[model samples]
Target: MQDWWNAFMPYPDVDVGHASTGPLSGLRLAVKDLFDVAGYPTSAGNAAVLAASGIKTATAPLVQALLDAGAFFAGKTNTDELAYSLIGGNVHFGMPRNPRDPDLIPGGSSSGSAVAVAAGLADLGLGTDTSGSIRLPAAINGLIGWRPTHGSLDNRALRPLAPSFDVPGFMTSSLEPMAAVMSAVGMPATNDRPISILIPEDIFETIDGVIADEMIASLRSSAMPIRKINSIASFSLADLAVAFTTILQKEAWESNKTLFEQSPDAIAPDIAARLRAGSRLDDEAMREADRIAALFSREVNRLLCENMVVALPTLAMNPPRRYAGPDSFAAFRSACIKLLCLSGLSGCPQLAFPIVSRAGNVSLSLVGARSADRMLVNVARRLSTCLKEQMPF
Candidate 1:
């Protein structure tokens, strides 16, 4: 039933959904393999990790909250092994099919969750975002992905991947379901729209020229007007990417080295080598990375202060074509990291909401101040309401 996209993990016997009437009463929830479910196994999409992770004895706090709010459990979805890669092709469990085109990589490590939601198999897909996992897949699949502020929610029992960047996140088809999930999870109510748009000076130049015009035109749409716009100082994508990679690699190496070391063949050879390289970084490099990260966090927060949100293209180009050569995937992934690293480095809340045009479907993300998750969603809800329908999400 939920397997058409290979999105839901192959587990039919572990049934655990609380039936009650609440805010999310009619929604079916898809949990990513990174989170624990009481009766289900958290495979984390790797054969070796699966062998080590026995059946979870308790449900994670966030998952329990959604279930308590009356969301029907669909099933645990697949993820990139140890949440490492963004391409979403699991060498172990097979890549989840992208329902949108079927030929594009469903941006991951939240691959299955995004595929399931996009395929109409579930209404809400609970995933994690560490450096664009949620946003990338949601954008590629034409869905709304929300990455909340780091540590803003109860994140117990989650397998860590770069603890400083990991945040529990979700993807949904539209604005309403996203709002419902937010309210269901006990987030505070938002009455007023928190919107004062900020555009980076060189964003258009940074992304590929192919869709740059479409993104530019979206700014003039009634949904996101340029009437009240201001310019935020630009940032170097290359510098940010390098700094982000340094921190992410060090943390990932510390968190997941043992798993790969214990079962080297269980993990992909390339990823294993990456982890090893991260472990080998000298202390001086690590210190410089931390310094840059801290400085950027302050700079971004200051710029996005007082309800101002930065709106930009969710991706640099588009999802890599499925089954493409390693070179193609690498170039696309690198370009995307430049676009996405700021959100992770700064710990801001980012919402990847759909923007439809004759150029086809693309997403524009609103990056807001930390802990302003509800505010960002409410702002987008207003925009979606005003935008022309039938534009094809």
Candidate 2:
């Protein structure tokens, strides 16, 4: 599987057995390289980081929980260097191919996890989402990607991107496996009643016209009552994006400063440049970013309370072409950050699911109130079933 997809880091295959009986008994899972696997060094997608990291003495509790529940481990998948980029093209390890369309970029830094699941190499794949890493890949590759509310899941053994925004997430082809995995980790059960849906007019308008129309049509066909809101709060999407980028860069720089300073050349040039830029951010800018983020979080929470959900496009546009030059790719990423920043800023749970459109596959996303992880999954399940029956597009 690794040979075909380039989805895994270069390491000997390691498989751990599951118990004879449990909910996930026969499932095969692939973990991102960032998680601590007992006796294996966590590479975090960089050769130097791998070399500097000593073997882990214990496994991440999340990984242990899955193993204890009867799921078998399928080795580590590749990640963006330091999990910094959403493009998923790692300079150190080669890009993981998008199984659905080989020429397109697989969304990342969770790139490999999405590929593993989409290609049927693994039943489930673990990845971290910090600023849309999980959801973006899930959207581009036509899979279910989930980001639990901030602090809902423990992050002790996972690699840090921006600790404030990073959360452990997974990618699967369908909702059932995702629900089973969440149950094993003790996530709360979802409410099964009908939910109130809110469409953020500004955010939806950011998407390409063709994709937006397809997404709207799908929502309408669900026969669920939907309301359009001019804004989630006083903040615009651009404002949220700026605030997220400012704080994320500041924290990311702090998290990886030592590595960047010690072995600058060991990191990929594009990622290294971004880190260097982060290091230059001043205290005043970060303080303002924090202030804006706090206000945004409060407003978003208010809007999503009481079984309410927000729907929007996962990516403003489709995935960029493979090897799109750094300049073009950078622009595309900036545009996407405008939409992705909403989830990060508000500390809410978001689920990205695929919608078949004339342009191929595009993604539709649902954002739920903070700590409403299970509800978002429930919504995705219902929406997925409806789409299949209606085939609205």
CA lDDT, every model vs. true structure: 0.84, 0.86
Task: After superposing candidate 2 on the true structure, give the runs of residues whose Cα lies further than 4 Å from its correct spot.
Answer: 15-17
Error of 2 at 305 (Å): 1.1
Q: Note the residue pairs that clash in candidate 1.
A: none
Question: In model 2, how large is the Cα lDDT of residue 120?
Answer: 91
Instruction: Point out where model 1 deviates above 4 Å.
Output: 191-194, 223-235, 389-393
Per-candidate TM vs. native? 0.94, 0.97
lDDT of 2 by residue, 1-393 (tens): 535988877786555556777888888888999999886789999999888888888899888888889888887899988999999888778999999899989879988888989999888889999988999888888898988888888787998989879999989998899889888878888767778888888887887776777788778888787888898989877878988999898889999999988999998888888898899999899998999999999998888887899999888876788878887789889999998888888899898888666777678889999778888888877787887888744
* Tens-place lDDT digits, model 1, residues 1-393: 838788988875677968578888989999999899998888888887777788889999999999899999988999988888889888889899999999899889999999999999999999999888999999999999999887887889899889989999999998889988877776676557435677675666777676676566556564553533333434477887898899898998998888866887888876787798789998998888888888888888888776787878898887778999888878888898887888898988899988776668878888888877888887777656655552446
